[model samples]
Target chain A: MFRILKKSLKTGVATGRHPQATQSSEPLTPEAHKKASAFNRSLAIREVDTGSCNACEVEMNALTNPVYDAERFGIHIAASPRHADALVVTGPVTVNMARALKDVYKQTPDPKLVIALGDCAIDCGAFKGSYAVTGPVDRHIPVDVRIPGCPPRPADILKALTDIQERP
Target chain B: MAETKSCDTELKTAFPSIVQRDTTQREFSHFFVAKDLLPTIARHLHTQPGLHGRLALLWAVDNRPARNTYELHYLFTLEPSHRWVLLSTELAKDDRVFPSITPHIHAAQWYEREIRDMFGLIPQGHPDLRRLVRHEHWPQGAHPLKKDFPWDRALGRQQGEHRFHRIEGEGVFEVPVGPIHAGIIEPGHFRFSVAGEPIMQLELHHFWTHRGVEKLFEQQPLAAAVPLAERVSGDTTFGHSLAYCQAVESLRHLDVPRRGRYLRSLFLELERLHNHLGDVGAICNDTAYALPHAHCSRMKEQIMQLNDRLTGSRFLRGLNRVGGVALDLTAAQLAEIAAEIDRMEQDFSELESIIAHNASLIDRLEATGVLTERTAWDHAVVGVVGRASGLDQDLRRDRPFAAYDELSVKVVHYRYGDVRARMRVRMDEIHESMRLIREIRLRIPQGPVAVESSPRAQAGEWALSAVEGWRGEILYMVMAGDNETIQRCKVRDPSFVNWPAIQWAVIGNIIPDFPLINKSFNLSYAGNDL
Candidate 1:
């Protein structure tokens, strides 16, 4: 109790998880892609950083912040994996992460999309040809889409997910 | 860069079985060692109070002959002395048995097990030692991390695939989470056996995206390998690149210009601030606390925005080269960023206050998932997680590398070792970071950001460079080859030791709080995945 008070007094910042904020919408395009998103639209996403450089993962979290305000699109990060639809993966696939990635991918109901966000997931990028990386998506399991960048800018990722609503 | 002689002295004292001293470079020296003394030396060094940098990472480099030699590299850090000691132990093809350091350090248990399962190096005494980062059913023989391991092996014969282990019991039901999941998440699995909500055994199975960075890096020269090293952990691009660059600089006897060093420090701190902010939000979200999560994340995004405005890449990716940072902040831009950070700091201060003002938040976070000071010291964890538990092991201040000598970093250490303590440490560090950014902004040095670096590295030369990353100390050992590719490149992330402590921290906590506890650690799985 006392320590928390001391810390709060020092930094004057406590990481509280919620505030009274409602959802709003914004599209990368001037108009919505398909009137309705195919990606379990309106679904909340909880991200698992099974093993990522956080390059791609950061973008996912960025979706919620006011800049992008993915909540405006009615999308939120669910606390549990059971509530998410699109599993966004980053980093060159590492050996240790294979099983966990697969397990998460499988649990998401049939109509799910796995977005391999970043160069490492697309073709292992520069880290390819290593004895450790087994990712770049498409290798271990099926990847619906690949967002290529050493790390895609948050705007690029925002565009990629919004673009999904346009795809048949 | 030429090899230095300090490496020779270490190989001699730490591992006397070193048969050959290969010190051709003026920066660092390498030694070919006998296999017998590897574990014993590791045990000796763990107890050595002075020979610091407590074995940060333990992994093997594959020398792919018909009789493959799995070489285990243990990277250590000695406090107050910014020196890194990397010791290697090689095992023959059929003989992979080596004693585990888990008995002494407890932290090496996971690292040794990972080496065992990934590269086929066996650590005999590792308790709970099983295949980590590999599927349970992954075949025993075809270790993926070995040099001889081919990229197309899965097409030829399934090596270490679909090999996740299963727990067997009656009445105790098993719930298996995925290698993929319902979330916008990465690949990994968790097998939980529970009678009720209480989880009896939580076995985390990973290894979906194993690109084999260590072997692939060995195939390239240090100069060409810069791109691969940057991708080792995407969020840590700058951190990994800086560590690698430092190691090469150490070996080549190259000095990154003073301005270059300052820019590198700026970028590293930016990376730390960004990641720490995300974690603060993440841990709160795990507790179902929405307001703080939103605030913390917004603060994190602001940093990313600052990074984009300053460095042109939000994650600070592609901004690190061999010699120094690829992105340089101009006088105007640095000032603007410093101003922006000042604004962000104010918001951070306000948001963090709101969370701290809440009684329920502190009640849940304090004393929950406590890692006692003694256990933390014994494991020798680095960074804030360790610092939160009363271990004063900050590499920047203790070792005084780079601009750390010019700057003051009073690490805010706490003895409580709980989620609250961890968050407190993060808050303290962010304030510390805000001060740093402001100071650096005011004291911006005028010069080129990165100098041209491409020294003709010899095969025999090696160097050790250690830096304090957000998560903790990241050590790199680079052995330059004649052709410019790395003969040996080993990177040790702080998470290697910290992750195991997560298991211990989660020991008595209910499953629901696991996410909150885990988030406080905020370790990079990809950093450890390789």
Candidate 2:
């Protein structure tokens, strides 16, 4: 119990793939606490491809497509482990991919949140029984949230991030 | 094409190695003597004039406690008439050395290597039988596919077993990529021999994830193999389930109701439709075509909900039991799926037009990773990979099973044999899936999705089931209800034969388009790595 409590305080927020984007939306000074509260919406997300059906990556590709314009919200794939505040993973956490998934978690810098998209990543959805898999991402890495589906809808993926902060 | 023609029992009779002639689920399979006939059968099958496009999946299956014989099963497909066959011959428990088939069927090259690493079934005559999936230092004598090989072993498998002769040639610096890759893909070790841009040779190292799922299933009950089947590939979930169900039904001698079969087909198409949509977008994203990549992926992502409606799980995991589907969609849900599919089909057409005229994208895909028709055929490839190479071998059309027996689904083939051809196949398949969905939605007969599938089975029972999944012919060969547990089950995926072709395709291609062309065939590393 103490370890969980201690670890919670030690962990930090996940950083986005493009750390530069976070600079633009920096929080106002302490003097502007009320204004910061008024800022209403800023989505901080972590994208993971748990063992991946690769369907997650396929739909993830759409986030940046011209029509959806993912960059408009500064949504980007996490560049490295150190900066991520929320981890969004696609795919089922394949056994071979288990170590990398854990490594990504260890590198997430702290207080990391994970959003597991697609069925495979959730519980080893499809690739569950094969000789090579060990997961649904949560087994190897702690998944805070799960977005089930072969590949969850992009709108839901977007909403998952926003919903996290809105939660009581 | 299958007009009263039957599998010439001659092959089985002549090769006394066929320990069993299995036809549990209407799938005809002959287990070959793997130790002696591996090379002979490979050569014999390839030489048969009528069996030009016949492909075999080379992998050893796990048979628990029946310890005297280690079964190495090879699954073969006869094209046009998708008659499937299995060859299971026993090898002495310790005498793992076997003749290689790689020389005859290029597809068996990697399959043999994977078998060698996992089952300790050494393909003696194989030309380049290097370490395929396991790491260089992975221990000797601890093959995971063996029944006694425990998953909980602390030290795991020991190290420093096999040594390789790394070339010491001039100016040939090797650029190693994965076990981990830059983009979001499976774990594989690709050792590229580069001489400035043009790749001299490519060596693909796999097996970072070897769970011996087939071995684990030998002790599991027939119904328990469902989750194991799903793990064949994270992306290709329903495909594996369809094949597993086929195998189980064959063992039980049960033909699923037409309603259940139609439901199975519905989930299968949904699996295919969403995968292609994601692939089209992913390939574009990999090549910097941001717009189409993202848009297509977004639409593809919505498919999860459709799957959730149809099957409780997004990837349709656990939806397929031994005899039929596990759950049924409500009337409203079915209607919702039909409506969503219509919307998706409309969006895909518009998406297709945008990608078709994108000349910059065309240049990136057209000639990249060109696997000639000859090479593709020589490898005995399947699914979109074979279709893209002018081989119109769709298991659905070639070997009719379940609802496919009634649907006249077109098998789209392209002779170009390039990245574009593969992408074209996926695009056309998505379009075809849209048609299939409309038909299923209109004709879906309401009935029980699943019936009783007793775990118990009679002795001397073996079954083989094959399905044309999104990737290709996904196969399941098993001895079921035997001792109330699977005596042996082999989940042979199309990726076993297709991964090597992707390795061969990258030979003359530039490094940049590697991701684009690699995604063309989109073979599952997890599937193969397993």
Candidate 3:
């Protein structure tokens, strides 16, 4: 128990300043940056993996760790879509998961934002042209933000989440 | 390298009439059997003491235009000798029906169902021929893996409920979990038949995310297919890609450089480290212990950052090419990695001690979700789950690919196949992996990371590559096409075999302990579904 306390002290403060700082770091216009910070202050996210390779899920999960501490910014991953203010979907929308993706979109309350969170979700990425893939998330539901990487870094994911303003 | 056991002479002497041609390669033996005698040979190879064969993978290839038939391949790894024997038989396309080996082998259940779903090959005697890969909405006779099917074709959604086997009893209620879960996990439906809190049976419905990974490999050039292989399972990026690269390298007969082998092993161990750390944490999280989970996540993040610094990608993506690794590690980077691993080891040991002293955590973990050794062998479970159940197998030590041929690997196993046993196996493996990474860093050869050898299109040639990935043995079978492209690429992720074992593990466990038990195995849904 003493060792735990000592270790905790040595760890120090590991949380990062989110929304305001992450949004400001983005090369966005000041007006847009302000809008993003205002909108993302107390965001509740629901992560939906349509047909991912799971790299995106790892990075997303990291956001909650001590390093990123997404919870510090009120960016909690909700357990249900009904409570989610935003749906962060990953992977290329697969054929079998298409109905579930759409159902998740419908379950989210009106004025909810959908963020496409990988190369696969954005443009079918590495999984493109496969018969099982149903293309990008936008093909199934309207995506407000697109974070592109095979899997975007955790910091990049935070930027994408905080930079969200409205449905594009 | 290990001595080549002449499985050819032994097999030919045993079954002369059935074995048409038996050719032995460096790692495995390819045997061409008569179509009608496939089941007979499979049963014999499995049961006979001389060749105690364990069915590793069962897949079917759509051989059109050249042969006008479908070829079924049954890959088995023989015990004692540890030699692989690939038994293949061709079925005429007009009557593409073969006797199922599931009744005899038992592990061939899902594989036979998958062959029927993907290639339209009818496994005649399969006990349950429910659609495995092709979703229920897929129209009859619309097999995705056939050569004639368009790569980008889409079939509109079909309406109807697929039948799930339910237990009929008074007060036995059914609880259906999801294709879309509440947590940040992949899509897989779990239907549980429970008498109050104890689960009587658990049926899994996977392949919701099957993106035609093999079919996608068909469209790309051999070099371009590395990315697809890496994405097969996101967490297993390096392992899958390395296996794919090894398959191509073997087919081309290109010898990788010493440094390349060392680097590949280094990256593979790093991948194992991060995943095992995260898994250990996640398992604790499931048991409602947040302290160990937090520390493990912190340590995992530290490794992830180290990976990002070593390779360009955090998951070590885009680092494996055809002949060897894409990027070369500098001397300074190697030194830094050594130091980081030392620090990680210290932090990990501290966390392990904390968990060790906690009696409540032990109470929750001990004997929860016990998968007996017999059950594990019946399902042919691989990786840590198999090791925990006393199925003494580790491809790194047995097969020895990459720099593992040179380095000594300490294979960890436990007789008790419970959640605690699995956790112990992982903890031991983490220490072993750390030792390996340190050794590789110390003795890494000074040479080029890759060989300048262009892979040509070789028709009718096939190669198999098996790597001991963090989850288990990740096997890749690649066949060359007539047009300098891949004819077929069969990937058997360890999760493919381990998922069925989870059903048996959860038979007596309560509903609340399900998550803790599931996380102990931590089988990949995307890997299994694909």
The prediction achieving the highest TM-score against the true structure is 3
* lDDT by residue for model 2 (B1-530), tens: 24213344556655665555434334455554555656676566566666542656655655546557666666666564455555566677567677777777777677777778777777887787667666554555656666667643422334454343365677767777765555555566677777778787777666665555566676577777777777667678889878887877777767687889998898899989888887878778778876676567556656865565556556777788877887777778778888888877776776677677778889888888888888888888878988889987887876788798888888899998988888998989998998998898888887776668654567647666678889888877677645667766767778877876777899877787777787777888657655
Candidate 1 — which residues are off by over 4 angstroms?
A1-52, A76-116, A120-124, A127-146, A163-168, B1-41, B48-53, B59-73, B78-96, B155-178, B181-183, B191-201
Over 4 Å off, model 3: A17-40, A165-168, B1-7, B20-24, B455-457
**lDDT score, candidate 1, position B286:** 75
Worst 10 residues of 2 chain B by lDDT: B154-163
lDDT of 3 by residue, A2-64 (tens): 878877787666566222222222244444444345444778889999999899999999998
Proportion of true contacts reproduced by candidate 1: 0.61
Task: Tell me the deviation in Å of residue A55 in model 1.
Answer: 1.5
DockQ rank order: 3, 1, 2
Which lDDT tens digits does candidate 3 get at residues B57-124? 98888888688988889999987778888898888759878998889988999999998888888899
Pick out the ten consecutive residues of candidate 1 chain B with the lowest summed lDDT. B22-31
Q: Tell me the TM-score of model 2.
A: 0.81
The numbered model that scores best in lDDT is 3
**C-alpha RMSD for every candidate:** 6.1, 9.3, 2.7
The DockQ-based CAPRI class assigned to model 1 is acceptable
Q: Tell me the lDDT of candidate 3.
A: 0.86
Q: What would the TM-scores of all predictions be?
A: 0.82, 0.81, 0.96
- DockQ of each candidate relative to the true complex: 0.35, 0.14, 0.68
